[model samples]
Target: MSKLVFQSVAVNTDPMTQPTPTPALSAPDLTEIQTGRLADPFSLLGPSHRGHAGHLVVHLPDAQRVTAVIDGTAYPLAAQAPGVFAGMIPPGSAYILRVGNGSPENGAQEWEQEDPYRFGPVLGELDEYLIGEGTHQRLWHVLGARVIRHEGVEGTCFALWAPSAQAVAVVGDFNQWDARRAPMRPRGTTGVWELFIPGVAEGASYKYRIIGPDGRELPLKADPIGFGSEHPPQTASVVRSITGYGWRDAAWLEGRAEAQDRRAPMSVYEVHLGSWRKRGDRPLSYVEAATELVDYAVDMGFTHIELMPISEHPFAGSWGYQPVGLYAPTVRHGPPHEFRDLVDAAHARGLGIILDWVPGHFPSDAHGLAQFDGTALYEHADPREGFHPDWNTCIYNFGRREVVNYLTSNALYWLEEYHIDGLRVDAVASMLYRDYSRKAGEWVPNIHGGRENLEAIALLQRVNTLTYGAVPGSMMIAEESTSFPGVSRPVDAGGLGFGFKWNMGWMNDTLRYMEHAPIHRRHHHHLMTFGIDYAFSENFILPISHDEVVHGKGAMIAKMPGDAWEKFANLRAYYGYMWGHPGKKLLFMGCEFAQAHEWNHDAELDWAALSRPENAGIQRLVRDLNTLYRGTPALHARDCEAEGFAWLDGGATDISVFAWARFGGPGDDPVVVIANMTPVERPGWRCAFPQAGHWDEVLNTDAAIYGGGNRGNMGGVVTEAVAHHGHAQSAQITLPPLSTVMFRYRGAE
Candidate 1:
């Protein structure tokens, strides 16, 4: 037997009494009714409430007959409208209804009326599915910080932060597109909408029907505060309740609740859901992907899984950065509940989840940010601040208080509501620099007239401050490519206060060296040693991101200048050196197995590449790199600390080599590392370790698993005498031709 939680079940008159309001009810009550399959939570089936009177209505869009078995009493109906019928059931009767076309008709549209609500009756036609307990309390349960609501002349006023729209209106399950029937009045100074629908309360689904100058009616959208939803590109609707979902991870939450700082080394595996896999052709359900990805990352030694934007967007290739619905998770891939299930499942596996949130810009979809609330509800009035000239997208107005609350609140919502571990703010450089894509005359400076965009910075600071305060374990990250100093510093210390910043400079410098130099001749000595100087500016993660491989840029493997075998070997060497270098690491999707072609968002990663031994070897190298990094104290030892790493030597390019040390703690072994970048292999390349005696080869770039020639001194072997400062002391040794060798000191006994 299925579980049912209904406060009170009531029924009214049948369809025969619908044309006129009957003084006496002829329909039977609960004793005469029978129940069919209970609709899923948010199911369009089951009886939907019609206004506040508790009248129930069901729609049969295509039906020659409408038969409802109420307590074993059956009622029949004829098509009164297009594939539709009128219906009024006896109050308090349990119902089992079947509506279908007795004779097949050629695509006729069907609808039903005679009630206050017009809800579609098919459960499977839309994106969301019914789950556990369905209740009014669960409806619109999620609260976002930014919804600007005020008491108005007749009712409460609500507004958003969409500055691009010329006009906006409030439309939903209510009003039926009557412009003046429930027009949202604009708040004079704020460009927000004011309305007072006294009857409208929680669970009353509504959307902003914005009108652009083109005279088109935008589709009704879901309120970001919706407790349960299918999300979008599907139309937003009111969900009654969800029951039976069991949530675990109490122990993890207990530890994370006190302070977010404890959750450090937030290694995130960024993923695009659709492109992550192929389910024969279509994308896998969130449950399927989440289960597999969590297992993969946890086994691979990553702490967190940061999903590329999962917000609702229409385009297939956008990677979820161009969001259409501010609050809704995309319905294109799967239902919202399924997404929640995925997060919950991940939590059960003890893995943290982060979402790549794009609140800085929105797409130009008429149904979304454009003309919302009869104006630019989600953006700014000033064209200079309202547009992203480079991306052809609408820029958000950071100065707006409501806007600030909306975005920051979204950060909090994902963490609190869905148990997301953190957020990686995308395109932060565009948000931080006013003149980023503008010419001298094309931009307006902030009040301070400084290079930094003050408003945007202020918004980011607030977002970080509030989000961190709200959830202590939640991390805030910035994808700021510009040289924004102190971006990851504390807010009280005059910085943006992000937990970490993507080290774009490091990625560029390293990739440039690998692409241009033969092992023998590298021009920029600073390329290898550059990060040490700036590593203290902010906590950084070196990322070989998607931007490196798309839009005609060849694959990372293809970028190496040599024969295919040599190129693979060269690539392995470069990665090995990078792993030993300062800062944590991130590689884009296809880089792991040396994907041959550029990344295509519509297609899956080149899985076929695994068949080739070279490609498989590269993958093995990446796995080893991650494993060794995690196992050793030196690699991530100094992350976010003042005395984490130091370079002993900085000069020389040809046969260039350098030594560095990373300290995890006072008594711990300061991991010593050395690198050689010469085009040809040097048989006995010599370097001296800072410490003396029996230094072991902990990690080698020349290993076969990493696509190298397996030509290197193996680990656990003692280093013999090496010449240093005209003295022979057993010290660290360096290999040749783009190689990095790691060593540990023998105890100081």
Candidate 2:
């Protein structure tokens, strides 16, 4: 499949007259070189193959005369063809080629430069072997533009994968964007082209100029493995070195495994950095976020900070979801190192960081991976398998071994290089199904005639395996909505290996129930309790994500069915119930302070609203909730286990009051959570308890400090010996109107 093609150094792109044959060169070889195939440009352009010592050749198009400078002595070379020159200088002597242009009457100008074709390859045999087998875990190190010393010359070693190309040239600012010079050499049978261009160091912008197999020049393409890029609307890859960052998260890294365990409380504060806050007219840069954002999250008692995708994207309206540069942390917020500063700041404060990783699909931008190498090399040719109609993007060909390797290695790069704590993989449900968002006949079936996409499933599994194996304490959470079993189970158990799955069913049901008026909530009571049916099926996170507050969904506060006062009360009660529920927690940025408007990716959050008493009260309630959740073992220790929870009064649907007990290990104390969803208060109403003892009112959603009337059981309650609701002990407690209350048991004396 690897056919040889010749390199062209034609001075004029329009057809040129065939030069008369010389003793040193054949006409067929000259024709191929003039056509620009670049299969082995080194053989045709750089040193003599006819055993003539000190014989140097270079293709300097448009050069009227060429001279070799050795030891400050200039020697003229005879022109073999148009723009092609060769001559003998001192053997084994270091030299530079001086290109002379213009006529003698106008005065000639000379430009001296090193010959790019004189440098040997940076990619050795081992890289080729691993690349051919598609097993290179560190593919980024080899594919992208790496600034290094090749052949005793300081330059950048550029490589690309375009097997079907007739010729590939490195075109950029260094070479005045000329495609004729610096043609890449295709390694035998590897489909990879390599060229080391001297003096092209960091910060130089570049793109690949490729002539397709049919000799058709394709659009200049961005590097798929590029670590840095020019700010968008300008689609050139910038050479960057991502090494030598001194990370300060050694303590956090050592304790991360325990911090991410199921037993640990994971209270995530999800943020869209671009909209979380602003400094005057623009969003905060990564340097600004390092202190402002990290300080805010720690002060609010969040365990981790989950940022929406920050990868380089052309359109800001996509909110970073349709990323073009997977390796690049968007230049919108400073360079890659500043992003590291943000991560380092979080870890310094003992907080974990998680990024929303999108690997399912990408935009069909001209400079992106779509139609790369003038073929469907990264995506599938079939639309049914490779197109995402909903997003208007192209799906990656996970079935291709090399493509899979490329993606899998990218996962490790973030964790290993950036020291990020976790990745919440986005839109996993779409990747799991072959016919996602498609009707019958518009979709394709798998080899087994099923709807499951086996390749994508394998890709997801492999990514989870590799990331977890490489990063000890890192997590791979899934944004999956389907009922596919064992989503959080291990891969060896024949399941998709994820650390946690977003509890979409619980979110949808609970929000639907909360939307109904208090009077009507009794009839729709089953909505809130239905989630308990499969609550412990998989490790879950009760997420109030950005998706819930955008595109006409309204903000969290608006979703409540009540007047001004009741709205605040309802949200506080809901937050109480959510924190007490059996799962991890994740709340979007504005939700903590009850932002009035729906989320807009373009603007900053309405932070001034926090000055209001009601809004400040909501913020205080969330802080206390996080504090209580983390401090109390009974509240979080058994979040993923059935035995850790017990319902006392699920049949209290008529009263709209629910009570449950959360237990820890045998010796650890238990906490009781009671939620009164209705507006009506119940004074001296006997509620069941696990034991006959004095229970302290640990948290009261209706407390006066939280913008509610100070109405609840005073400090503590003592249980009487009256059997009630299948318990030997019952407490005569006061239930505030539309509130949630928590109690901690001391002992039975």
Best by lDDT: 2
- Over all chains combined, what TM-score does candidate 2 have? 0.94
- 665: Cα error in model 2, Å: 2.3
Instruction: Give all TM-scores, in the order shown.
Output: 0.74, 0.94
In model 1, the Cα lDDT at residue 116 comes to 14
Top TM-score prediction, candidate number: 2
**Clashes by residue pair, model 2:** 6-37, 6-38, 7-38, 8-33, 8-36
Deviating ranges (above 4 Å) for candidate 2: 1-36, 48-54, 62-65, 70-75, 89-94, 99-111
lDDT of 1 by residue, 1-749 (tens): 01122222233346564333312211332111111111121122124332213134343333466554554454443333343333445554454444444444555432221211222211121111111111112112222112222222112223333333344445555445333234343333333333443334334456665554454545554444433334444555343222235667677777654323421343456677778777878776887877787787777666567788887676666788887655666665665667878888777776777788997898766555654544665677677778788877888878766566666666776776677777889999998887888988777887878767888898888878887787767788899998887888889999998988899888887777777647434566777677777877788887777888888878998888778876886787777777777666677777878899998877888889899988988887777778777666566666656576765545545567666666676666767676666556666555544555566667776676666666666663354566654435444343645567677665543
Clashes of each: 49, 5
